[model samples]
Target chain A: MTLTKQKNQLPVFKKMSTQPWSLLAPLLIVLLGLFLYPIIEVIRYSFTNLRFGRIEYAYTLHSFKSVFTDRNFLDMVRITFTFVIFSVTFQLINGFIVAFAIYIGEKLKLKGSVFVRTSVIISMAIPGIIIGVIWRMMLDESPTGILNYYLSLFGFGPVRFLTDPKIALISVIIANIWRGTANNMILLYAGLKTIPESILEAADVDGAGSFRKVFSIIIPSISPVLMICGLLSIIGTFNTFDMIMSLTGGGPAGATEVLALSSYKEIFVNYSLGKGSAIAAIILLINIIMAMIYFNMNKKVEV
Target chain B: MKNKKTRGKKVLIYAIYILTAIFFLFPLFWTLCLSMKTVPELFQVPPKILPKTIHFNNYIHIIKNTLVLKYLKNTFVLVGATAFGTLLISIPAAYAFSRNKFRIKNNMMFGLLIFQMISPLVIAIPLYSYLAKLGLLNNYLILIMIYIALRVPFTTWYITGYMNTIPKELDQAAKVDGCSRIRIIMSIIMPVCVPGIISSIIINAMSAWSQFIIPFILVDKGEKLPLSVGIINLQSTSEAITTHYLAAACMISVIPMVLLYIIFQKFIVSTISGSVKG
Candidate 1:
């Protein structure tokens, strides 16, 4: 019926298309110039041997080869996996713990839950760089450092947080977890609300223990939210280098240099655009894999 | 017996809630303490939670000694323009997407989803060279344009979702009354969409204000940097500013955003949670 009407009013339909296209013109042009063109350029540059100093370049596989063969390449790959996995795991756990606490608190008619709710999100308001600085200060091993100072009160001396290669990645992960927990909390808190109170009450009537309800019912019900938080956390941690730059600068001998930071240092600091673009291409591939997982997860959930 | 058990659970829950609140709030509290102490106090063997004497001078010191004032000015213009430009560029496209049956609409929407997944870091290398090649490096306009490009996909997707709720009959009525498409948007659709648009602006502004990498990579001059980059730049200066001064600077960059979050707590909380809800 709609097709017949459109055929009868072909002039109106034609005019409609014209207006929509015109309205879409600005977005289209901007996307081409900034988003699409640059993306194509990144992939293009990944296949070239362009450096900052030299103008002439060849479309060879030198960049990919160099990036893959660099002594630190496998190290970076390991660091990236470690960073993404640990950050996602701990962030989700912290988020769920805080969110569940809030849920239980609200159920119990506790007034302190409001404070917990407000406090959990405060760090999210902070920029990643600031969070890095604050946490660096917190984890500062100096005599004046707050955490260590308290540790001394308990007979523990300062621990090397950022200096030790063994400990530096752990510190970065902690800062990232702090930077990321609020997002997890928000997403999972929203998820928790979707489980009807009636369901919990029924469980209570059935003599279901708290652990059982949380493990069996609550987990299954919010599986989609957990999946979202997982995918988003993975992709987000994979791309971000700001906090890491501030906290570690991929430092104490490249101990904390994730792929994003490595690509950044390659292009800007090292002045090799091709290698950076190659690293970026790899990052993009990882992102696309995650995106594929994201799509498949959404499809599964919908089914 | 049931009542006794329930009360014990209640006590445990409150204990967790209070402890969690402190755990989350500790870093900011420590920063505040650090920002207020004198330079010597920062290095004192036992760090004092409350300073010997609170100094507001660190805030004064940064403005007097650093490029913080200039950075603040640059950020206001850069972030303000990016938010305005994003809304301006995305809203029309969102309206068009929602109202019309176009050949490329589905494809365009899907493309936007893919683009949104590609972080700005992934494209920054090429963007740097591309902008540099055009002799547009360090130009504020290019940065703003880049931010708008980065922000448009999500904003368009958000506003399109918003526009779908406005009944099309209103557009039909306005058409019968001979109102043009643009005029109807400005008068009819926009007014109704103001709440959604405000949420979009707040979200966009938050992200833009926090942006470090893009601006850090593009704008080379200290005088032109945003707070996220500016404060870090100051932290790395050779003169070796004290921890207290650095803390003050971090606090300076953070306070406004926290204040904005506090003010828009309800709107932000609901919008973020609701945006991702099934």
Candidate 2:
């Protein structure tokens, strides 16, 4: 019946002419109108000193010059890089350990290990805004702070987790790591799952210790995944706005101020579209560079 | 002796897992615990580990006095429309990109990938001004359209990868059976790729639902604000800053996402891993 159906319908296949662009045009139009157009506008707007309410526009490179010359821009860059480095480091370490343990549990057929997986999922799905707000409550400087309550149980004094300039960036980093590690773990575990059991068994037969096997075998096999995760973590951390806004508001005198938050402040708060667009353009350049490297590495891995 | 040693290691690993779970989950657990406490309990010298009575009134109060419910409704409207629109556009695009051969296809996909990397905050200023010029600031249509654009690249990428896994033979077979391209896609590919479409929907829904800065700056009205912006607004206002009320609102905002995760946990995992593999 199927063979006859194909034979009878073969003529129709040649006669029907449907262009792929017809299907692709809607997405293309939206991307052009909304995505690419806005980006071009941002790049153009960055060159103009377009402050709100005074529309006598002077297109100049002053915004970029000021952003480059300002001491605060340097501080924001330092804070942003520092946050990304520390948070990604913590996430990688914690994610690896959890993923490894889960892999071991799967190998050993451990009962009740499903709960561990669920917990990780739960953590990953908790939205960043909630993470920021709840952490704010927990990190309150007063004794009422939950973290402070626990610290006092150990006879430690109440610490200004988000209030002090020195500790504010670290506090935000900790919150981000908490929110992000589980996602890293989930992805890493999936990568681990792809490794063939025969390789591990062969290593065991060769009397290779677990640590040696992990370093020599498992790590190399998953290095591509690691690279992808790291790049994504960097991008994701750089995009951190809601959390910073809710947690520290880039506060304690801009200690936790990242490029994203800086752009928000310059644009929305100060109504300096020129400066904001310049900073945003800087961010776009950084991301594009990172993505180019990612693509090159990814292609090599595929080959 | 060897068995005992391995058992000891296993026990140690489980202990570490449990300890980590506690450490990682503490914030959420604390939020839930705090939401059930009275205002006085919240301000107690050392916060009570368990509230003496589980105060149900916090939820009631937020529902009565705040825009929490309206915020949820607004979020659903925004996310639902974005998700539906994303699928509407992306499904056909993915089908074409996967099934048809065309010049500039790969370039288009790569362009979309680069667009994906550009965060909305980077373009927020220009977008805001443009929307203002068009008199569409605080407009639901503009915000939804933006959300759809923001999500389209990712949805297309994921769905195209999924469509590739579907055999071309099926398309050929359907075409020979006098079915048009649309018919083949809708009847055959769409049904087969439901999981992929769903994963895209859930991911888009979550991102759109939890989006902060776009809706924060774009929509000015309190009633129009999504849950994320609404909850933050609740916290920012001095009058609404009570711990229990904030906790309750936060919990309410997250429940739908949590339930979605519970239902589609595997799909989410597969999608993330799939991106890496791609």
Candidate 3:
């Protein structure tokens, strides 16, 4: 009788297993066909001497060697690292500060808090490309440019915001910070909201000052959110392409060229398909490594 | 004495708040002012903080010259098509993962997560080459396909988290009521999951509409370009840097998205917060 019952349960288990596969099969097929296949093809192409005409017929490490040895490759690597580090740091600091201000405003029932928060939210809604264009137009060095025009009134001369190589990277960084910081603020704000009011009140009752409360309670409470936000900002800043493309075009002597822009120019503009793919693969590797290191270090934090 | 101190602090807080608000909003305010000036007047020795005359004609000129309607139409179609397509595929997959434990489930989910983290730019070159080979370059269908592929992992993860929150008892009861799997999904599961679905749709739609890099690299033809690309092209090709026209274009390009955000601001903001917290 026991054997019979166990035998009957086998069919049910089999049916349950089959059901998921039935639903998942089509999705798996599409992912394999559309996403995986092309990625594999790119990996294959990266090992070859594939170029404009012989893309289908060549296979070698010639392109990889060329990419590694290219004079500008190291510069590109340095620029990418610098961009990611600076952008993520600034974005995190600014994001947390603004989020703290908003949270305090909410607690105190400050006037115009709602308006300020909403406007910040609206900034996230604007597309990056549009923000880039708007900044580019505003920072035009001509006396009539909005930024220059304002400066002149204060008895200052027009500044070469985009044209000056020294400032071009900074200009792109500002546009990026403007477009991106809101998302982080929203995330951090949400994290703040999740912290119970009682805990804060308890701290206040204990005579904990604002700075003490923030350091002792708030930071520890929101550390997980900060980790996630930091990881996301790192990934985002590393992968950023659109703003850089629009604002600087990696111009003024390639002053603003990041990995994404470099790979793009190589693949599309120069038609060095193999080298481009190699650069792309390297970027992919860097992201994966950093993400792995992050997860390993903070294994207890849940996504 | 305590009340007076509180009042003094409140005043100080208000002063700081107003100053910060002005500083944060300067760019938008500056853009608004510049939108009202003609090209020549835009370049005056002192920048026009406020325009003397409102150049409503700038909007008309920009609209006429840039084919703004076509760009808008393209954006709508691309966003709608991709959003719908992503949801249709992702929902079932999410359900399967969340509700059904089966062979290779863990591996598949892991794969999806890894793919979600991969940057689209890394795949752009290969995808472009493959699409070019297939003669599918510049086609809207390809864009839709690529967007769906790129977005599926995140959408699936999002929907699965939501699906997991719903009780399994409901599904069991629906199954007992002679509901087929398909019917149960459509009738029982989807209705209860509207909030998640809406969040997914809005988030994906925003990304799709705002997407620039993929479309920039993929599509070559001007007529096929979306608003993001189209606006850039317009600004670049214009004979002179017409601040008014650029601002007008910027304003027009921003309106639809801003309107959407306004309409769904509460849901969008809450959903974003929820997603981050989760």
Candidate 4:
């Protein structure tokens, strides 16, 4: 009907119809110049052999070959996987549980539900960088560190949270979990609310227990939200640079080194633009693939 | 028996809720506590839960000595420019995308989503060399421009969602009354979407203020560095006397955003959930 109406009105509105294109032009120009052009430049740079000024300025797959063959490449990949996977897992579970609490609190008209909601929202607003700074300080391997100080109360000695390689990656993951849970909570709670009340009520009338209702009704209903949230958590954690940079600097013998940081180091710290761009290209490829899956799932959810 | 079981379950839920809230909020409280502690108190064995004497001087010292104020100024400048630039650029684009029946509209919209997917780090190297060759490094304008580009797509996507909510009849009526599209967008749609616009501004401003990677790479000068980088340098800026001052500076930097979050809590949650839904 709208299409027929639009067709009928096209002759009369042709003059005014051009206005939208004009309005879209500015955003189109800015994005092309800054975002799109830079991406094209990055891809082109990745294939070339341009160092900070040591010959070999030719277009070849040398940088890509070297990146795949580099000794630390596999280790960086492993670290990146461990960080991304575990952080997303922990973040999703914690976020879901907290969101469930908020959902229940609202359902029961609990008094402090508002306060709990406010705290979660505020936590979401706290910058990742500040989260890094505060957690770094808290996880300091000294008695002064808050976590250590608390642990000492339980008869544990000071633990090297960031310095001990075994614990450093976990430490960053903990900080990320801290940074990410609120986001998880908000999305999951919103997801929970979207579950049809009739379905839930139907389950209740059939004598479904809480766990059964959750597994049978709630989980299936919110699975799309879960998928989107999980994917976002993974993507966000994978792109993590600020928090990791501050928290670990990818140190303790590079135990915390992730792809983004490796890209950062290769470009800025080492000034090897070719290798850095190559790493960035790979990170971009992974992100794009993950995002494609996310959007695919999202499309299904919307439908 | 059922009543007792339900009450016990409620109690358990509340317990978990309170514990999670405490876990989420402890960092903010801890930062505040540590900011008020003396160096001796900071290093005290087992650490003091509360300071015997509040060291207000830590806040005063960082403000007086370090580049804390300069960092604030630079950050405010970047945030202000990016927010304004984004609004100026995105509002029109959102207006067009939402109100118009242009060809390639769906493709452009999908492109915006793809743009959001790409991380800034992916293009960091090329952007660095490009800006460096242009002599734009270490400048607030370069960082702001990049930030505006980084945020504009999401902001535009957000505003477009808001614009789609306004009934098309208003635009139709305005157009019949011979009002131009721009005027309709400004006079009609803009007022209705004020809450969304404010949320967009607040969210973008906070993200811009907290942004690290762009400023970290783009700006090399000490004076030009934003708080995100400067606060990290607090440790290296002073070897032995770092902890209290770092805490103090961090508290100062974070309080504004916390305050904004408190004031705009409803809008923030709604905006996020809206984006997630999309």
Candidate 5:
């Protein structure tokens, strides 16, 4: 029934027509005005000395020079990469484990798989700022802190989870992993479900152990998903500031300040519009590069 | 021996499930526990594992005295406008993508993907300039516009995917019967993809709820702040805040989203899986 209608419709598209533009016009206008134009402005503003609230400005490379030469920017690059690498690495590993567990539970008809899935997904619904707040509460560094209290029971001192510069970034990364694992799990689990069950069943019949089956079969087949999850985690974690902002506000001598937060602080806190725009332009550049890779990699990208 | 081994495997699976639940759910549970405690209990020598009695006062104070309601109102305005505006623009664009012949279709879809990948915080700088220039500071209209624009790219892509799943005959028959383009989309395409549309709206609303950097930068007025921003300022500024009160406020802010997920959990899961696969 549907094939006939598709047949009737396909020929009309053999030649380009302006008919679709009418429907596409609104979205096109928005992209141009909001997405495209502002991006150009960010680029333009990056090359100038445009401070906020002072109309007088000139086009120069001072902002770019300062941003590149600044010691803080170098530190931020190192910190940002550390955060992204650790967050992405752990999110993938844990996300896969959770997805694998759910898959196994389903195969064996476990009763509580749905409940476990719900608990994991619950984190996704909570706002990022709230996640930071709750983490702060949980990570209170005093002796009475919930995490620290538990640690004391295990013969450890009260650890400064957020205050100590060395541990602060690690704490932020942990919170990020918690926030991100749900997305990775959803994606990985979907990929797992697609691995022709026949293959796994065949492995079972061949007397394959669970560990060997995962290594020899499941991991290889789902390598595409695993790569995508890692890429997305890096990009997403790199761009995030809310969780870090509310959690630590890039504090404890700025140990946790990543590039995204630096851009925000430059513009809003420090009032250096040119420098902020320069940082933002760099961010846009990185995002575009990563997104281009994603576009090419995504199976959905017909382009 | 085989039966005993299976029983042990079952125990292990249940153990994993229990541990996972505790890991994910404990913080929220901890907050709930904190919200019920008295001021004395909060700063006690060692924190009490549970409150002696549940306290409604913290919830009452935040609900009645604090900006929780105001923040809720502001968030509703922003989130609702985003969902509504995105749907209004994206549905037609999605219909166009799925049904019509277009030369730039692939390129446009790719452009949308790039925008989707770049988070709102990255664009906050550029949008900040526009907000300053237009003097839309503390205005819902500007927030709504930016949110809708950012969301249009994503929702359009997902909805287009949904429209692709639908049979062409459904809309073609409507067209042959002289149903206008608008009517065909509304009556035929939309009802068939209700779950898709609903899920798109839910996803848009979820992002809008989580938005902090944009609204935080633009809407600086105390009363104009959304829950996300308001709650942050509430935490940082007020040194005198008892722990229980803050927990109560946190609980209030998250409950709606939690409820929405519970009710539509299956719908959301299916829509997301379908969108990804399709």
Candidate 6:
């Protein structure tokens, strides 16, 4: 049916022979000038030794070699991967659990569900940088800090939250989880709301408990939303910079240096434009690969 | 017996809900309480959950002492310019992508998706240099342009999704009634896409307001800084950990957004859900 329509539409396309290039030209130019030009410039500069005081345009792989061989580079890569994995995994699980719990609570006509949902939304509204600062203050190792003060009430010692290398990554992770879980909750809550009540009722009639109903009905119903949310979480976690930069400054000996932070440090702080661009390009490539994998999986599932 | 068990379950659920609510709201509550406390009181041996003396001067001091007004003005201007610019370009482009059976339609859509996926940090280096060459560094216009470009793809994608749901027959009927293509778009399509426009406007405005990384890197001059960057600067340069001052700044930054959220909470939530679902 579509093929025949396409055959008929060919004549109409021919009759309307005035190409819309005039309309499209300006948009194309804007994109090329603003978006493409910078990208091309970055690629061009990445192969050369570009610095603050000097622009050595001579093509060399020296920067790439330095990035590959530098011990800090390897450590940065390891730390970045660890941070992304740990943060994203925890966020996904925590977000899913909270969202599901909220959904169940709402279904039971639980009091204060509205307030719980509102608070979640408010959390989403807080800026990431501010959240970092606030968490830093709360988790400050000083006796006067809120977390430490509260801990002392229970006879617990101050746990070095941001200062300790071992716990710094976890501290940042917790901060990110707090800032980001609201986004996931909104997504999952929306997904859950779209599920027909009849399906759950039918499952309940089959002698299914709430746990069984959630596992069998709700999970499968929202699988697509979950996949998209997961992919978003992965991408966002990989690119997170502000929280880490503000909180730990990727400090305590680069314990919490994610790729984005490391890339920024190389580019601006260290002025290694080539290596920084290389890292940036590598991050982009990884993101693209992940997105492609996600789309492919989504297609298979759809089929 | 069954009713009693269900009631018990309901009570348990309420308990859980209340606990989660407290957990979620604790930070904001802490900020509010700390805002009311003096620095010395805030840093007391046992950190004061409530202030002994409420410092109403904190809010006044933040406004009087810092460039809070300038930052707010800068942020508003940047956000307004970016939101308008993005909408102007994206709405027409999205219409073309959705309604017009143009060649390369799929390619354009795919290109937008790719752009959306790529992290901004990846392109920040060259963007900085490019803007510098153009003499646009530390300029609000440069930030505006970057915001527009960064947001256009997502805005276009979302508007395109919304546009697809609008029946094409409406366009056809308008054309038959002697309407030009532009007129058809202006009259028929624009009116129909109000929900999408509203959603995009709110979402983009919020994003532009909260933008940190781009503005932080691009704008070096203190006067050009947005509220987010300005707050960070104030924090770093200030001598004392003045909880009141910090909280005051935070309140200044967030109050407008909070009010906006309250006013348009329903539309905002619906639009967010719609965009995500699409």
Clash count, predicted structure 3: 0
Q: Identify the leading candidate in terms of DockQ.
A: 4
* Candidate 1: residue pairs that collide: none
TM-score of each prediction = 0.94, 0.95, 0.92, 0.95, 0.95, 0.93
Residue pairs with clashing backbones, model 2: none
TM (chain A) per model: 0.91, 0.92, 0.88, 0.92, 0.93, 0.87
Q: If you assessed candidate 1 against the hidden native complex, which CAPRI class would it receive?
A: medium
Q: Which tens-of-lDDT digit does each residue in B104-178 have in candidate 1?
A: 676787677667788788767887887787877789988999999989988887788778777766776777677
DockQ of all predictions against the true structure, Cα-based: 0.56, 0.52, 0.48, 0.57, 0.55, 0.46
Chain B TM-scores across candidates:
0.95, 0.96, 0.91, 0.95, 0.96, 0.93
> By DockQ, highest first, what's the ranking?
4, 1, 5, 2, 3, 6
Candidate 4 to truth, TM: 0.95
Query: Which of the two candidates, 1 or 3, achieves a greater TM-score against the reference?
Result: 1
Residues B1-278, candidate 4: write the lDDT tens digits: 78886787689789987898788788888888888988788778767667787668899999988888999999899989998999999999988877677677767877787788888887667888877878989976667788999998889988987887777766777887899777988899899999989989998998898888888888888889888988877755557457878889989889888898899888888877873553
**lDDT tens per residue, model 6, B1-278:** 77897787677677766766766677777777777777678668877777777667788888888888999999899889988999888877776666566677666766666677777776677888777777888876667778888888788878887887777667766655777766877889989999889888888888888778788778889988988889888888768537678877877787787777666666667766662442
Query: In model 5, what is the error at residue A126, expressed in angstroms?
Result: 0.6
Q: Where's the lowest-lDDT run of ten residues in candidate 3 chain B?
A: B269-278
- Report RMSD for candidate 5: 2.7
Per-residue accuracy of model 6 over A113-192 as CA lDDT, tens digit each: 77777777776666677777677767868767787878788988788988889888888888887877777777788888
lDDT of each: 0.83, 0.84, 0.77, 0.83, 0.84, 0.75
Which residue runs does candidate 1 get wrong by more than 4 Å?
A: A1-19, A299-303, B275-278
Q: Per-residue lDDT tens digits of candidate 2, residues A151-195?
A: 888988678898789889899999999878877887799889889
Off by over 4 Å in 2: A1-18, B276-278
Question: In model 4, which regions exceed 4 Å deviation?
Answer: A1-16, A53-56, B238-240, B275-278
